[model samples]
Target chain A: MQLPVLNNTPSQAEHGAKGGCSASSCGTTDNQMDSLPDSIREKVQNHPCYSEDAHHYFARMHVAVAPACNIQCHYCNRKYDCANESRPGVVSELLTPDQAVKKTMAVAATIPQMTVLGIAGPGDPLANPERTFETFRRLSEEAPDIKLCVSTNGLALPDAVEELSKHNIDHVTITINTVDPEIGAKIYPWIFWNNKRIKGIKGAKILIEQQQKGLEMLIAKGILVKVNSVMIPGVNDQHLAEVSRVVKSKGAFLHNVMPLIAEAEHGTFYGVMGQRGPTPDELQDLQDSCSGDMNMMRHCRQCRADAVGLLGEDRGDEFTLDKIEEMDIDYQAAMEKRKVIHQAIQEEMDSKRLEKAVKAQQHQQEPKLTTRPVLMAVATSGQGVINVHFGHAKEFLIYEASPEGVRFISHRKADQYCGGDSTCGDGESVLQLTIRALAGCEAVLCSKVGYEPWEMLEAAGIAPNGEHAMEPIEDAVMAVYKEMAAAGKLDEKNEAVRANA
Target chain B: MAVSIIDLCVNCFACEPVCPSHAISEAKPHFMVDPKKCTECEGDFPVFQCASICPIEGAILDSFGVAINPPGSLTGIPPEKMAEAMAELQSH
Candidate 1:
């Protein structure tokens, strides 16, 4: 069987993912992070952050205080609505800063995980300083512990950079793909300031000017800056190296190279004439290329402003915007109440099972199918001379790539070395089995594992893969082998695990 | 047969004015990326400018199927230098 592509099993990759993607990088180069003052860089590396399924857990509020933006990009319109929140063909509900704050507090009382607060949206946050700062001030006084994060086009960030540093806000995401104004004109339609509409080349100029100034200011003030660049195939892809160059020079810490997702709903995607969206593979590949000096982001979930919880770990979108508003005041309390409901459901399931069993008893013609399977890890490596572990069995399996290719030669009867476990009992025997299995062939592809087994594998310079649902053994083995091959790690055919044992 | 555009466009316009082979047309409410003329931006820039500029994540996708860069994943000389100094690196 051929290896199914990544799209076939996304859940295995991203569902509360703790580790980084082995293949995709976050477009972060080395020079910027390495050159940073150890104090600052360490803060960044250790920063409690997650992507895709990983929620910031912190509740962030974007007071639509910055109701107006001076600059307009092709991808943006000062529409009374945002595409992320509204249904397609529908518009976002606009709220004043004061109204927004009231709603925020009311919502915060219910969610214990709400921690961060800031202004991020349609217009630049700093553009409307009075409303933006006022919202921040009120939130600070009200929820002091909550961290603040803001995303901006960086147009007016320069003027307010000092003010931002003064505020308790610690994290900032600036959208800057091209430092060159020539290309910038295509994305941004215009920039308005002092009652003047700066069009075309001039608008791009203003944007670049402000982005440079803003990024520098944040770095100087020691505020962690994360630069977000939209990966547009024809427009700025050619120039990302330039973007990477400038971003690194200015001392930016992280680069989020997000793929461009055009939608008629957002108004950001202007022309729908004949273009297509990027496949997942293309996005991962692009992320691998432009991720200069620092780590590349493989796991950008393109989260909503109000997105809640951790990646892969968040079982479902239960904390979604619609669900939260309709949920009970206390979320945990509500969840506990649901557990009660679940317990009731389990009792109902047990009753059904009992009924089915009784029916089978009455209709005795059908045979009862009771198969309590014993799971075993057979090592086909080498024969162990010392205990009954005998490692050679593990070696035999490594030579064959297929189950059809595998032929068991010997069967050993247990009841010999007994300490506890059945089949084979001795701890030494178990060790031999594990070591031999680890040596033969390559990785141990199984359903699930805990830290204990993972650690044992690591100690012996081994790796582990757990793709729970992919059926039979052949499919899983082939897929694992393909990925290993793609990553350039499949060793010689003769490599066996049990030989050392 | 005339090259036809499909219905999956999202108005990203990643294929506009970037027709090196000059095969693409203007976006329709969005635009269609011309693959034949794409040449994958072969002789021009370090990467495809259209794909880079399309901010609508995946709006301007890689039709040519060429692998591009991500953030901070450079293994060799730096990522930027890889493109600008492709010749130099290749010779080495």
Candidate 2:
């Protein structure tokens, strides 16, 4: 996969990691593999954590059905925008249920491993029964391979459980910060339901009561439930262990402890109060401390309402929220742009090499010796040839400065070789190319020539005088070539190769 | 597996799901238990799966009406967790 090499400087992971990935700048790459989502919590644990080998992988995309939400939370206000469009946040484009279905199909095609389909935030799915159910209805009808998951504050869950069950949605994640209604109310600014702004404690109590009911409903129905517990320092961090205890007792399968990312500018709770986000370690300790009873989800990205893919995966850098309709175009354009950046990198490396080669040939100034003695191979008949044993990419750099337009003559092309060829034009065998390169040669140098070529060449009796030992193809060839050339022995057979070329 | 529904059953289908084969179903006519698929999670879990999470009492039962474990009894966890893990693996 030629991903965009946004950072040519190369990342530490890329240099030493198994994938040999060259892209280091993309933030998503680091967070490529996330904790299994709550929906697939149990099912995914059954699958291999890695693909055979421990290769980091990306999660499937999730599409948010924004138009619906049952009980409104204080923080949620969905006016769709594909804003910066890295993940699902604000939908840049909204879609009809039919349009969403088609768009998911298109997204699945473009992103090969679109494992789970998701709908979260904007509004609870149960609240906007018309839009949410229709989206789920259409998705199940069209593409069933992609697993289904939904996240809600859990307000309208009870009423919608049967519908979710009918579609066989295997996993469900509900965000429950504090079991306390007082705290819950403080967290949420307002709740709009049945056409009214149920504000403060009133709305909080209603939403919490309803959400808890929803969790109970989901558990009773056998839908695997995962509890997303956000840790708001000084708020619910201390109460988290109790949250774990209660949910675990209720048959909740897992608890995902997430850090509250206070959107300072959003005028949200922490932002208006000028509170900073938890240091990663502080959040992790809280998660670890409260992870017994249930499989704790440590790797949650807390993706925007429109988040898709495995837990914590942002498609690109900026958490994006595209309207379900524009998912296809936005993703494709991002992919294409990533490709263009990749192509540009390869071209740069090649040009850099080409420039160096030209400068070496024109300068012809023998490099001053710094360490051991240096050896240079002159253009013998301008058909400079070097026979190789094992072709490696590093072999080409030796003649990188040779005036001898060195032509590599190989017996068999090796896998992953940088440069070498054996096919002879006019059906002659590399005997011709090697002969051309050996033309006017003082001595033909190689590892071990086969009996036939050896016999024919030794028949000329150009003394085979050169140092020999186990070494790389290029080094060995250069060693023997320079040693033989310095000794200055040649004969009639070498003249024949010159004429052929 | 004739059993009474317990208080803990919010009726979330978490239990009915992992039942090996197709045994547990919806709580209709009092959330009946199908003994056929109720290997008591022996196919996976070592003890009665229902009791593990049955917030209420006696949600799971044998044909003879014995609760998987009386509420006051020691937890199904064997004194040796590793031994239980090993024994469960052997059963499979």
Candidate 3:
């Protein structure tokens, strides 16, 4: 199946020539967003983690106030002094409710784009009810404009839904790995419930029932729910599509299938036992399979519990407890500035949409180009841009370009050739493997390509181009296809020669 | 009989919170279960809480020094099959 076309705009090929949708333009005009009620749309429009479009413009922060979890996940290794770690369940420092509020105010004052405050936790937010609720209570009273979010394991979620709604918590994330108790048994060892520890499939059954019940109850209160499932290679990878389907049927607004991080250094059970995380290709395939059932959030960064700033960045150190204590923040003045800034951003986005509409109209009036479809690969680190370096790319998003427009085919996993150093010891064989991974692609587009890989790609009959660096992947792939067509490379005989080469 | 967490524990902190007896504490290498306070969930839980939540195979032992959650009990993937899967992944 083709990647979901997010926008309501006509296909680029329908515009005849020199017309393709950019990531920002397409994401902003999401058909799904248009279908939602105005209230629901307003809630998600600016949440960086909720709307794939808004992440480019907005920022979110997670306060590590909750440090206790009720359920045991094999992938979790919650410890302290994890300042450099980027995974969930890791935090630099734990904060009290008052300190968390102070830090939030300080961050909001300094960063006007910071509009959402989430309590994702170094542990389950609902598990630490008092600490989590106290932080939310203070934030809701002081900073009423900022969105409040809570993410839970869903074990304690059913019991805490009432308190969540009381605090105006509209966005809730539940990490539901599976609906089947047997598969859940592999991921969660036990859950403490009703003053007792339930183990194996029994505990899983209780957790799943509570999660489904919590999802229904939250939706009844008109709260938006996003289901996050960890894609464990053998454990729950194959089971996640069903989970997505089940959650979507239960009124979940979005599904974020995050890859499990099982690196041995994290000291998790799966890591020590040599359990492998799903490859990028495997993850993309699962997301694609489930996209038909629900709106698949393809831009999740699997943020840390104490994550700060934008989705891909962290600025937690900027607003530490000590730093917050020293600085006096005038929240009233900050709120005024934020309102003006948010209005300006909305105006800019409006103009961008208008510009894209005009371009589409112009292209539609032009004569169509007769070109054959060619598959091209793009190196991107999300945001739908051709931004990743050739050596650093873990996956290449394959796209098909023809007179029909550019369409995302699938993702191809590549063994990274560069290890972030100047060493090139075994780069040759790795590069060969990468090229083999992109067998049918006519060209590979990236931000930058090394001289050796460029030469090798050319020898392999796959043109390598970095000219469209930072451009939208769809636009870049279409431009490359146009270039190939101009060079008569799309001719039947030329195609045969390249294939045989 | 009280349960014990061996050196094989990876410091995952899974067992510390679920202990009904409040017997588990963080130590240098890994978590340790106190014999004095440990009840093994005799009247509280059907299964030992520490052994039930410990992710590593054979990380927690019973009073007789036998693994509560032995290899292949949690994941259900046999040791040989797990090794094969890892080798295949590494080869890729």
When 1 and 3 are scored with lDDT, the better candidate is 3
Ranking by DockQ: 3, 1, 2
Off by over 4 Å in 3: A1-37, A79-81, A293-296, A357-466, A469-477, A485-501, B1-92
Candidate 2 lDDT over A173-201, as tens digits, reads: 88888788788765765555433445667
Model 2 scores what on Cα lDDT? 0.47
- TM of chain B, each: 0.46, 0.51, 0.85
Between prediction 2 and prediction 3, the one with superior TM-score is 3
Docking class of 3: incorrect
TM-score of chain A of each: 0.55, 0.52, 0.79
In the range A266-288, model 1's lDDT, one tens digit per residue, is 33334221124444335444554
DockQ of each candidate, alpha-carbon based: 0.02, 0.01, 0.15
- Candidate that would win on lDDT: 3
In candidate 1 chain B, where is summed lDDT lowest over 10 consecutive residues? B68-77
**How do the residues B1-92 of candidate 2 rate in per-residue lDDT, one tens digit apiece?**
33334443434333453345456676643345666555655546454544443322355565676765453221222234424444554563
Pick the winner on TM-score between candidates 1 and 3: 3
